[model samples]
Target chain A: MKCGLVAADGAVLHRETRPTPRVVVDARGGGRAVLEALLETVVELGQKAAADGHRVRAVGVVVPGIINAESGIVSAENLAWAGTPVLAELKAAIGDQHVILAHDVRAGGYAELRQGALIGTTNSLFLPLGTGIAAAMVVDGSLVSGDGYAGELGHTRFVNGEAAELCACGQWGCLETVASAAALARRYGVRSGRVVDGAREVLELLAQGDPDAEAVWKEALAALVDALVMYTTLVAPTRIAIGGGLVGAGETLLAPLREGVAARLTFQRKPEIVAAVLGEEAGCLGAALMAWDSITDESGEQTV
Target chain B: MKCGLVAADGAVLHRETRPTPRVVVDARGGGRAVLEALLETVVELGQKAAADGHRVRAVGVVVPGIINAESGIVSAENLAWAGTPVLAELKAAIGDQHVILAHDVRAGGYAELRQGALIGTTNSLFLPLGTGIAAAMVVDGSLVSGDGYAGELGHTRFVNGEAAELCACGQWGCLETVASAAALARRYGVRSGRVVDGAREVLELLAQGDPDAEAVWKEALAALVDALVMYTTLVAPTRIAIGGGLVGAGETLLAPLREGVAARLTFQRKPEIVAAVLGEEAGCLGAALMAWDSITDESGEQTV
Candidate 1:
């Protein structure tokens, strides 16, 4: 879990990473332990802020899940969270401070829009290709929440025919099944009959002209280009910032995507394809920024 | 060509349609004649409203085109308008009356949200499967403009493999190529070796169990189901209203869509499929409502 204390002016006062509690997720409510760990982290952070001679005005918590802003409930498959009352627990843990709960990818996109790659653009997308893929859609100057269900771009179908793979989302031939970082590594291992460390190793092997790595890389790129083209046709974004693990390949990933999307587009406006600038700290920073905005919005004060 | 004199309380005081003057869209600015026809229509409507003991405070114009809201420029292929300053011309023709320019599909959606089928829903889609297909997307309670380029759901690739046809948008197998009203008539003729009147005739043939008509209808439904599932996965709309000439088939078009979308969806939220209520008047009504809203917004008056 990444947590931080951020000032109103976008400065990080304190930063730290804590291990997320792991439990055997079954029918006996194992997710409670994870929730307890999150509560404890917030309480300790507030205490640490006081000890460091600073006052904590608000708290922003971002998680990788579907967040219901109205009821403050969260549902995450990996964390074993189903309709978990994360907001109420956090409020009880640290009383009298404004609390903001948001999706991690949306927060990261918010951070990018405010101070990173997507700055000065209204219609844009923050697409992160990690273990799983999702999107943060900034349409007409606002990050689209769609009641916390929007921006599931990876789950949309891109792969077709016999080459299509079953996605974890239970949908067939999803963009995530072919283009995600985890898919690249897994496909490389299956194709070459050799295990790789991760997509990092797959990239390295491709650099050394490995045929299996090259094939897997090409498949991922093709799926990604298809997804980008579909998004452009539907949403017409002005720019798209590619983030997460796959972007570490830099131009190896972006150049092909640019060429492929450009070649496919006929009438749609071409968007600038760029890498995300904030790295991993984006979610944490965005949470703090949102917290600050909450205060400023209520008080009508220009803080940032 | 539909024009209306609508009251602030959503009453249609007067309504009429004018023929768009035909001009050969070749060289020498043939589009200028179309622009002139539009200008004359607006001017005559304003005069009629004044003579009918009603003060014309505002005028709203809706068009099927890419509208640059900032510059008031419009580009519609059928209208032969490329970067034509429609707003400026309207303003010039109508003297000092406030003129609000908007997309026809979006205007229709706004009407539906305010007074028709999609009322009380924050996230929904107004999809009219017309001669040409486009969508009016209501995301997070606002109509997405994407600078006049959003909501081209029809243009997104859905049909694939050998059956994929070349779309007018230069893409292969767009949803519009198979699912549009024009596509239905055209495909039926090609399959059955008999020319039909339109989609209505195709629907009639399907009711009588014509094999070619059944095949074309089934194909359209399959592509539509794919497109809807993709949209539900991405945007998470709670309801979807189907309009345009194709909706005239009623349950013949809607029942299959609902069943197909339901059977396909797994982890995504399923949207209620229903026929649009306002029909042809939606766009004109929406334009009037927007015009009134603009006045009410600036004056801080509660008109509705």
Candidate 2:
């Protein structure tokens, strides 16, 4: 992805293009190959940028799954890597420069907190319901990593009925199984025997008032509301930023969801539910911020 | 309830019984009369302890609902308290002593994390499923109270088909309505016209092979497992401590619930489910710890 860095002070500086590395295919091989590949890509990009007269002080990599930021270990289920020393690899590739590795959703959440829907909000939950369900937390002006395993919202169980559908994580009735974009398509296929390509088609069908699509859409909305209600009850953040492929439904998803959650809350404060402003640029922006943080010293100020 | 505190180091302390004050009713009248009474009791107890030559440096009070520790404001639907300045009131009554106010479940969780079922575990959830469901998080030896509203687990929605039950919180199909101890009793009343006094009687009936009791019990277990499965996917805790009224069912509850959760979890690590060790005393013990922390100086050593 070719991306430009936007500083906190609204200064635009430097442009770089780097290939997103393929995630590990096998759970074995000890993550050495995957880490090596990631390092090589960053180094190549850094060299190109430097030759073009742009100084690249740091590199940021976003990965899916559990991450221990303090230990620099990535434990992503989708990736074949577990406990891979990503920080060391990035440093070895770029040589003495800073490297920041963060959970993709959390990084996205940072983008939202800084420049998007969650701006000026101290407490918020950023959940991206895509191929899977995961979330990020920004509490008291700081993102909570909790040893790099803070936000995993998708796996919470949403259904208590029989195991009609099994989640990819092997859990039955997980919120992800019912609320994600993939779940919308799967539910449609199960009910009507037509395999849709993505959640967008289902949304289009629902807009046209297709009964099957409407039913599937409502089900997914209910599931999403279930998770959000629980989150509201627990954290009661000032706002909740919904992103990822599923959120592309936009107001079609946001309006009813807000109403549903509002109907549930009585004494608890109702948080504003809004669409993410960062769009697809969230991860890259968050990476840049983290990279900036890496180079800064003890006063905790980021000078990019 | 008259209570005794056992410190983390196994030192036992006693507080003599006295009637809770009636003055709090003047500040907020009616059903909240009990809460005021409890607060008054805490103040009276603190004064008496000081008069008895015990150096009481801090006071910890645990209440139900959403609490903001930093601001000392409490909001609980069940208690009908919105923005109650509990810490201020207690501080006024108890003189210069530091007052620590915490959510009841989180306090219970603190007790478990320090000395009970969750001992030595880095990440654990303490759930007290009584009149309502609330959870406490202990991550890496620190209690996670995201703005003091981090443990409201009962509000998580539980969707099952189209027939959704309305929750007391005004939400439809909340997990508490289906899985809490009160929920079990309520289900028994609706299903078989049996007015069970509490979850204890319902469990008794289930043990006696009563079909209605068995059905309701199974439903509760399913709902609980569903919620836990979702929680595990997100936080991936090392253990989950089940406390409160429902946990009184003991092995009967823990055994089947564990099996159910394990069966549902496929890719995630299966956390051990167990009964809380501190039992009824968890809240008090936890409060004391919080009180101790409030008074302890910066060197990380306790003076009281």
**Fnat of each prediction, in sequence:** 0.88, 0.70
Give the top-scoring candidate (TM-score).
Answer: 1
Question: Which digits, one per residue and each the tens of the lDDT, describe model 1 over residues B27-58?
Answer: 54678888998898888887787777777767
TM-score of chain B of 2: 0.89
- Report iRMS (Å) of candidate 1: 0.8
| DockQ each | 0.85, 0.49
In the range B233-255, model 2's lDDT, one tens digit per residue, is: 66668799999988888898999
- Residue A195, model 1: lDDT of 90
Best by lDDT: 1
Query: Please, what are the lDDT tens digits per residue for candidate 2 over residues A1-304?
Result: 5455444443446555655456556636535655666667676666666666656656677777777777787776556776677777776666777678888888889878877899888778888877777888776567777667667677776666564467776656777888888888888888878988888888888989999999988888887887787777766687999998878888999999999888868756689998887777787788777777666552432222
Q: State the fnat of candidate 2 relative to the true structure.
A: 0.70
Q: How many angstroms is residue B213 displaced in model 2 relative to the true structure, after the best TM-score fit?
A: 3.4
Chain A TM-score for candidate 1 is: 0.96
